[model samples]
Target: MKLFSCPSCDQVVFFENVVCERCNHALGYEPASNAMLALEPTGTAFTSVGRGGDGRQWRYCTNYDHGVCNWVVPGDGAEPFCVACRHNLVVPNLADAANVALWQKMEIAKRRLFYTLLQLNLPLVTRAEDAEGLGFEFLSNDPTSGQHVMTGHDDGLIVIALAEADDAEREKRRTAMGEPYRTLLGHFRHEIGHWYWDRLVRDGGHLDACRAVFGDDTLDYNAALQAHYANGPRPGWQGEYVSTYAGAHPWEDFAETWAHYFHITDTLDTGRAWGFVVNPRVDREDVLTAMINFNVFAPTTTIANISDAWLALAAALNALNRSMGAADPYPFVLSETVLRKLGFIHDLVHGRVN
Candidate 1:
């Protein structure tokens, strides 16, 4: 995250600030430019000092009425909504008091989604009225409605139920899935892998390489998922697949690994910014290798493996958490198999393969 400023006093501010500590100006995120903006209230409408792409004026989406966002849309970018807000298809029933709080938690996680998307330069678009493109729908089965609640992804779209925003409900699902760690942001990252692999890997001449690691994604997803649940994974899945369910199908493997790649990159970038590492370059493989002794990403081009870099950071995170009497920050152990996946991800990210 780049540093933000309080537009009122020109003093430095943080991303999640609702009111500037320096000058007390209200602040909200401008998703189009991924910048935090300072605002002055004028009766019903607020004016912000930021321009969207193409030099358009903007303001917070009216959907804040529904509690799903804290973002502004470009005035002349001329969309009816903000970039993040535009993705909504069926929002939850906010008339219910509990749903309002649920929606706010989802917004916080969704904003983090936008931050990573902006940083990675991913393409984002909303599915317009009965039109085709990337889109989203926040839905559920209220018993009043016949449809079942599902958090699933399909054809460049992802559907998440409002209930998943609840911590207890999500923890229930995570326990059922037999996972070590899970969170709303993890779900967002995993689903996004499905969207991005469609753009980055399929039919982009990366199919063969992806197949070698993730398996052929050509099998029927429904069938694979059924088989996975019915019979479980092959005897020892964690030895090969990063996650147990990832071994169920090629597509699942790819999505899981892609999510892991995002996790590694984001954490490394944060570490870089906080001065955990000496270099500030955006690339992870190079930056991480220098700080840790063992290096492995891009072996043909680089000196060696950077396994030690990750280890060092992992140690620091665990130590910090331990100091606070909290669980270790990273719970999973990285075997050689996982490191190879990380290397493949590093290579793919750096255009070493392409």
Candidate 2:
């Protein structure tokens, strides 16, 4: 994500900012312009206050009332929710304060996912637009059954367990699962990978190309997963798969690799925005040097550039965490085979696959 500034006061702001601290102006993000507008109340609607202002009235998304969204829509538009919130098919009951708080956290991560998707200019359709269009369901575990809600994707609907918003509960699960990294944003990116696999690979007629890289996804998924749990990941799986769980099935390999692609590109973009350059003085071979000066989100950007810069940036990030006595923010290695998988995703996203 890139840094944003308040349109009125020019003070640096964040993506989720609802009020600019410097000028005390009400802020709303306009996705079309990808700008944070400082607004002036105009009856039930608002008017942009500065530089990019066009004098057109705008209204905050309906979800903004719940304090979970800060996006704005054209006042004359019929839609109540902004581009991101419109995909939400189900949300936990907001009447309960605890659920509301958790749901807010879920929305924050979900919006960041959408920001990346929009940046890539990927296809986004609501369930109302297509039968298998992208949608979301933030659900809580059934109180009566005491069954936990699984965070997974079905067709185009991505279900996120509200419990994952709780820091202690999520950390406990992460430790139990032996995962090095886990977050609401990570979950969104991973599950959406499944949705895109359906759109870009399965239905987009790239199955043969994908299979060549990810293996035969036609393998029985349930059997593969069952065996994965019964027996551990295949020996020496690290050389080929992004993670042990990715080795369970070709489908999972694709999803895990897909999620990594997002992770790398987005983090690199942030580093680029900050004008970060890594050139460690002690490096003898210059293997740990990078200049993060390119637009990583560009379709024309080569995967080699991304991979090189990511390695440098990730190494520096891990070192910084160690200095603070914290776990590495990125603990996984990108092997040669995994890089090949990422290349496929890069090509697929840019329609470069033949």
Candidate 3:
């Protein structure tokens, strides 16, 4: 995500900031302009108070009252939620304070996912608009069944387990599953990848091309998953898949690779926003050198540029983590085959492929 600034004081802000620390102004993100606005309350609504302010009134999404969202909707608009929050089919029970806190964490990650989707100009339709439109449900374990909510996607609805919000619980599951990296953001990206596959590939006439790259998704999904758990990831998966889980099935490969595509472009965008450049003085071969000067989300941006910059930035990030004794922030390595899968996603999103 790009770094935002408090429009009133030009103080550097962040994606989730609700108030400008420097200017002491209330902040809200306007999705249409992809901008964070500093606001002054005008009755029940707010008026923009900085450069490019048209004095137009804005109102925070209804979810803002719960301290979960900071996106704004036009004051005169009929919609009660912003573009990102409108797709919510269900949310955790806010009556419980513990649930409220967990849901807040979930919303933060979900909004970041929407930021990249919007930047890519991908299609987003609420379930109200279409039966198979993208939607979300934050659920907890069933009280009766005593079964945990599986974090997965069904058709267009994505279910996120509230248990995943707890750092300890998530880390435990990550360890048990032998995943090097797993987080709420990763869950959102991976699950949404399935929805996009339905919309862009299955429905958008790219099935044949996608199959050639991701393999035939028509294979039995349940059987494949059963085999994956029983027998483990396919041998030599590292040479062809982004993650071991990706080798379970063709659909999974697409989703895992799709999430990585988001990971690469979004992280690269952040690197570009901070004016990051990788030029190691000690290295004679310039293979590690990269300048994140181009917009990673642009239609014109090539997968090669993104992959090169990401490799350089990922190295710096991993090194920085090691300096503090933290695990590598990025743990996956992209092979030539994985890069080709990512390229297909890039082209699909940019309308370069049918």
lDDT of each: 0.68, 0.93, 0.94
lDDT of 3 by residue, 1-354 (tens): 899999899999999999999979999999999999999999999999898788999999999999999999999999999999999988998889999999999999999999999999999999999999999999999889898799999999999999999999999999999999999999999999999999999899999999999999989999999999999989999999999999999999999988999998999999999999899998689888999999999888999999999888999899999999999999988899999989999999998885
Global fold similarity of model 3 (TM-score): 0.99
Off by over 4 Å in 1: 10-12, 42-57, 129-132, 277-308, 346-352
Better of 1 and 2 by lDDT: 2
Q: Give each model a TM-score.
A: 0.81, 0.98, 0.99
Which scores better on lDDT, 1 or 3?
A: 3
TM-score of 2: 0.98
User: Per-residue CA lDDT of candidate 2, range 1-354, in tens?
Assistant: 888999888999999999999899999999887789999999999999887888889999999999999999999889999999999999999889999899999999988898889889899999999999999999998989998799999899999999999989999999998788999999999999999999999989999999999999989999999999889888999899989999999999998999999999999989998899999999888799999999999988999999999999999999999999999999999999999999999999998988
- Predicted structure with the largest lDDT when compared to the true one: 3
Question: Clashing residue pairs, candidate 3?
Answer: none
Model 3, C-alpha of 90: deviation from truth (Å):
1.2
Look at candidate 1 and give me any clashing residue pairs: 294-305, 294-306, 295-304, 295-305, 295-306, 296-305, 296-306
